[model samples]
Target chain A: MTYCVGIRTNEATIMISDSRTSAGVDNISSYSKMWRYGIPGERQFVICSAGNLATTQAVIAAIERDIKNTAETSLLTVADMHQAAEYIGKVSVAVQEKAGGGAVFEATFLLAGEILGSLSGLYMIYAQGNYIASSRQVPYLQIGEIKYGKPILDRVIQESTTIDRAIVCGLISMDATLKSNLTVGPPIELYILQHGSLTLGRYRSFGEDDEYMRDLRKLWNKAMESAVDAMPRLTLS
Target chain B: MTYCVGIRTNEATIMISDSRTSAGVDNISSYSKMWRYGIPGERQFVICSAGNLATTQAVIAAIERDIKNTAETSLLTVADMHQAAEYIGKVSVAVQEKAGGGAVFEATFLLAGEILGSLSGLYMIYAQGNYIASSRQVPYLQIGEIKYGKPILDRVIQESTTIDRAIVCGLISMDATLKSNLTVGPPIELYILQHGSLTLGRYRSFGEDDEYMRDLRKLWNKAMESAVDAMPRLTLS
Candidate 1:
């Protein structure tokens, strides 16, 4: 299981994903699920995957392979974010059909990025190759073990949230997920892409022992504890 | 999809459940998932159901029939809390087999109660007729759409947590679930049973327009929003 969340705010689009994968309790492994594709200052796409590792890896490999082949419908050939998402979706669907047969080779993704001129956005790609972008009413999309971390995003994130605050909210949401579930764990990888700051190195990975991650976890836990403590005390009538 | 949470504390045990049941997105209706079976003051058990609505109703009907029949095993005939849990589990399995041959008549339960002289505890019964009790390390058990509401419970509930606070935590957990999930919603039924207060009428249902429910929802959303605001702002190094 993986937990990946993408927050699209007015200033920036942020995507965060946990790095833990386990076929079972005994076969636990760590795999980075973040992939960036683009030409610097022209276009950028950050993809966070969750589901079958083999399928996700295959999709990633296929996307990379497409970039190397001009004939293929690569991200570079796509004119807009929608086409980029559709291309990834098509690649993902074709890869699963060839590798998984009738079995479930499910891999969902959160794609967030911007072209040179169009609106910056976030899209959640389904295992079935369909996708939906974030709207004004809902400015975030989450994949994988999403439920554990969703309440915080539902409450705190908005279209007007600042990039710094969006990053913080995404980190808090990821922290909540990592604490409650083993399938999703650190190091958490985050890509913060503002609409125009298309520099190639706008990504960071917070390892298990990273100072900021530790402090944020402790801080957020205390904050949530206090929130519950301050709830109205119910009295028997 | 239902969301039922039961928290057992040193002083009191409480159970809260949503009232929504659906065959699909198009067909949905409200059905109370809470039931109580016991002699007042002498013994009482609160049962919260999640999963197939038909199977849950069937199990409830069977338990009621057993209570009326002195020959068969029933909640009344059970000697200890374990026997009571096992009896309910067995009845659940039998009822599911009868109604849903191979079509997955799954219904999970949270059973919390006490006998006249035995311990007051909580048990989570699986569809396979097996059950596990809550421990000091884990003082709460949730069924149905549990993940959305789990982080708050994981961070707040403890063995020493006050019954009032546990009730608050349960409410917050249920509220989070109801907000993020469609399968779980109001009217929310809650039961607060203390170690010694084996009283009837402790059960209350907060309807969609309940004032307190509205206030708590507003309060919790504000609390979470404030928490996100208070996070240490991240500065790119």
Candidate 2:
């Protein structure tokens, strides 16, 4: 299981993903799920994957190969973010089909990035090769074990949210997921594309014991406890 | 789909459940999931249902029939809380089997109650006739549409938690689930059994527009928003 979320705010786009991947309880391992691709200052795409490790790796390799070969319809050559997403979807489908039939070969992805003059975009590509872009009413997309982390995003994220707030909200959402589920654990990887900056604006990874991670957890916990205290009591009449 | 949770604290035990039932998105209706049974002042149990609605109704009817017929293993005749749970599990399995074989006939339950002299118990009965009791380390059991409501329960409820806190936490948890999922909705039913009373301490049902429910949602959302503001900034260096 995995948890990756992409938040598109008016000022920036952010994507965050957990690193833990487990085939089973005993087969747990840490693998970064975020793959960065682009030519600096020209275009940038951050692809976050959740599903069979082999399938995601194959899909990423295929994308890298396309870029390297200067394929007619690669991420670098796509006209806009939609086409880039569609190309990834095509690569994903081809890879899964070649791997043969089974849910085991299934994978999903969140693609977030920008091209020089086009509007920044965030999209979720499904295992079936279809994709959907985020809308102004709900400016986020998630893939993987998403439920535990979703309430915060539902409450706090929207088109008008600031980039910094979006980044923090994404982190808190991931923290809620990691706390409630063992399948998703640290280190967490995040990519930020600040408005107007063509290339990735900031990227950071935090391990389980990282100071910032610790502080975030502590602060969030305290705030939740206080929130609970502040809630209206269940009065029975 | 349904969402129900049982929390056992030192002073009392509480069960909360959403009322939404749906065969599909278009077929949605309200039906209480919490069923209370016991001889007041002697014994009491609250069973919360999830999964096939037909199967749950059948199971409840069977329990009622057994009690009315003075069956040797009925809830009124069970020797202890564990036996009562086992009785419910047996009844559930029997009900599912009688409805013929299909996933649609399977049901799960959270049973919370206490006998005259036994310690209060919280049990989760699986569809397979097996049940597990909640432990002091984790004194809550949830069934159906559980993930969206889990983080708050994980963060707040414990054996040492006050009953009021547990009740509020359970309500907030339900609210979170209802907010993130369309399949789980109001009116929410809650039952409370305070320690040694051997009778229900309180029972309340809140509709979507219920004033208390409205206030709870308003306060919780405000708290969460403030929490996001109090979180540490994601300082990039």
Candidate 3:
């Protein structure tokens, strides 16, 4: 299981992913789920993936191989962010064709970034190679173990949301997913793309023992207790 | 869809369930998911249901109808909490047999109570009639839309946890579920059982204006934001 979120804000785009992967409780490993493409300052794109690690890595590797061997169909050579997303979908389809083999494998990606003077859009691409762009009402998309972390995003995220708020929302959302799911663990990857800048900036990870996460856990617990205690009691007949 | 949770502590047991049931997002209705039985002083039991509401209600109705006709197979006549769970499982099977019609209708029940001088216990009964008792390490069980609210329970709940703490944990867990899932909605039912009390105590429902829940939502959002702000930045390479 994995948890990855990408948000498009008025000022920037934020992408976050967890590094933990597990086949079962006993077998756990860490793997980076975020990928970067394009030349810095010219055109920048970021893709965060979730679902089957093998499938996602294959998709990314296929896209990278295309970029290395052929420029016509590569993300870096795409005309705009839309074309970049199309390039990703095409690569995903190619990977799926080779690896699917009549069996079902679920892999999805959240693509967000700018292409210099062009658009910065966020698209959620499915295993079928189809994608949907985020809209004003739904400015963010989450993949893998998404239910646990969806409430915060549903309540707070919007098109006009600030980069700082979006980052906080993304983190809290991941925090909820991590607490509930054993498969999603620490060392979270976060990336911020300032609107129109095209280049990725402010990429980081929050690991276990990070003071902010500790405090968030403590405070969330305490606040929950206080909230339940303060709710009015319902009397039965 | 529904959300129900049961927690056992050294001093008491807590059970909570939501009233909303939905076949899909557009089709939703209110249905009670809690059932109680047994004599108040000698022995008492509470059962919370989550899954197909029709199946659960049929199971509860079957139990009540049997108790009305004969004490020999009644919940009130069960010798111990384990026996009571078996009785509930049997009733669930009967319901399934009557309405199942070769199709799978999944329903789960969380049974907890004490009988006179006997010990108190908590058990989770599945659709197939098999059950598992709660242990010290895992002191609670939740069914239906459980992921959103499971984080708080995973972090704060324990077998030796206080009744107040457990109650709060249950409420927060329910809150998270409610926030994330429209299928699990308002009018939450909560029940408490003190160890050796042999009776269910403190049953209540929280509506939209429920103050404590409102405060919890507010405080939790604030706490999450504060926690995110306090997170340390990763030094770049």
Candidate 4:
């Protein structure tokens, strides 16, 4: 299991992913779920993967292969984010098809980035190879184990949210997911792409012992404790 | 779909259940998911239901029929809380079995209460007619749309948590679930039974416009906004 989220604010596009992949309770391993590909200052794409590890790995491998092969319709050559989504979706479906159907080989992705001239956008590419973009009204899309991390996003994210605040919300959202499920863990990968900046932007990874992660947890816990203590006492009226 | 959670603090057993029921998106309605059966001062039980509404309704109906009939094995006559769970679990499986096998008629329950001579306890009765008690380590069980509401419980609940705090956490947990899913909503029912008291302690229902609910949401949202703001800023180190 995995958890990933892509939030597109007016200021930037932030993508967050947890690295822990578990085949079962006893066999857990860390694998980076976020992949970035592009020619700097030209266009950039960050793909976050979830679901069957092999399937996601295969789809990602196929994407990297296309870029290396200089295929006619790779991420590098795709005209727009929509075309990139279509190409990735087709690759995902083809990979799953080649695996042959027996058990579930499904994978899901949240694709976020921009073309040279267009604005940054977020798309969720489904296991079925279809995709949908985030609108201004709903400026985020999440894949994999989404629910535990979703309420915070629903509460805090909006069109006008600043880039720093949006990234903080994304990190907290990932924290909630990690706290609730052992299958999802760190070091969490977070990528931020500011509006109009086609470069990779700031990329950070948070491991278990990382100071920022620990400090954020402490601060949130203190906030929760204070919030719980200060609420109007229930009178049972 | 519904969201129900039961938390057993040393001070009290708190149960919260949303009122939404739906066969499909267009056919959603409100239904009370919490039911109480007791001999007042002698013993008490609160059964929170999830899954097939008809099956839960039938199981409750059958239990009520038995109590009214003054049967030898009614909830009023069950020797202990475990017997009560067994009785309810058997009834649930029987109700589902009676509905035939082509479709799913399963229901799950969280049973919490105390008998006159025993300590207060919490039990989660499975649809297959089995049950397990909440321990000091776990202290809570949730059913239905559980993930969105689970992180708060995991973060805030403990053996020493106060009844007021538990109830607040439960309300906030339900709020998160409600915010994330349309299938779960108001008015939410909350029941708290204190230890050694074979009677319902506090019972409250929160509707869409309930003032306390509104205030709590406001307070929590403010808390989250501030928590986000106060956290250590990302340095991308």
TM-score of each: 0.95, 0.98, 0.88, 0.96
Relative to the real complex, the DockQ score for model 1 comes to 0.71
What lDDT does model 4 reach?
0.88
Candidate 1, B173-236: lDDT as tens digits: 9988988998888999999887876666377789999888898989998898788778887766
* Pairs of residues at least 3 apart in sequence or in different chains that clash in candidate 2: none
Any runs in candidate 2 off by more than 4 Å, and if so which? Answer: none
Q: Better model by DockQ, 2 or 4?
A: 2
Give the Å shift of residue B61 in candidate 2: 0.7
Q: Report the C-alpha lDDT of model 4 over B1-237, residue by residue, as the tens digit.
A: 889999998889999999999989999899999998777789988999999999999999999999999988988888888898899999988899999833479899999989988778889998898999999998999989999998888878897999888888889999999999999989999998988877756799888899999999888887787778888888764
Once superposed on the true structure, which residue ranges of model 3 sit more than 4 Å away at CA? A22-28, A101-103, A155-169, A206-237, B98-103, B159-165, B208-223, B226-237
Model 4 misplaced stretches (Cα beyond 4 Å): A101-103, B101-103
* TM-score result, candidate 4: 0.96
Docking level for model 3: acceptable
Q: Quick one: ranking by lDDT, best first? A: 2, 4, 1, 3
Per-residue error (Å), model 2, residue A218? 2.0
> DockQ winner among the candidates?
2
Native-contact recovery for every candidate? 0.80, 0.79, 0.32, 0.72
lDDT of each: 0.87, 0.89, 0.79, 0.88
- Model 4's i-RMS, to one decimal, reads 1.4
> Could you give candidate 2's per-residue lDDT for residues B1-237 as a string of tens digits?
899999999988889999999988999999999899878888988999999999999999999999999988898988788998889888988888888857878899999988887888999999988999999899999999999989888877789988778888999899889998999999999889887888665899888799987888877877777788777788785
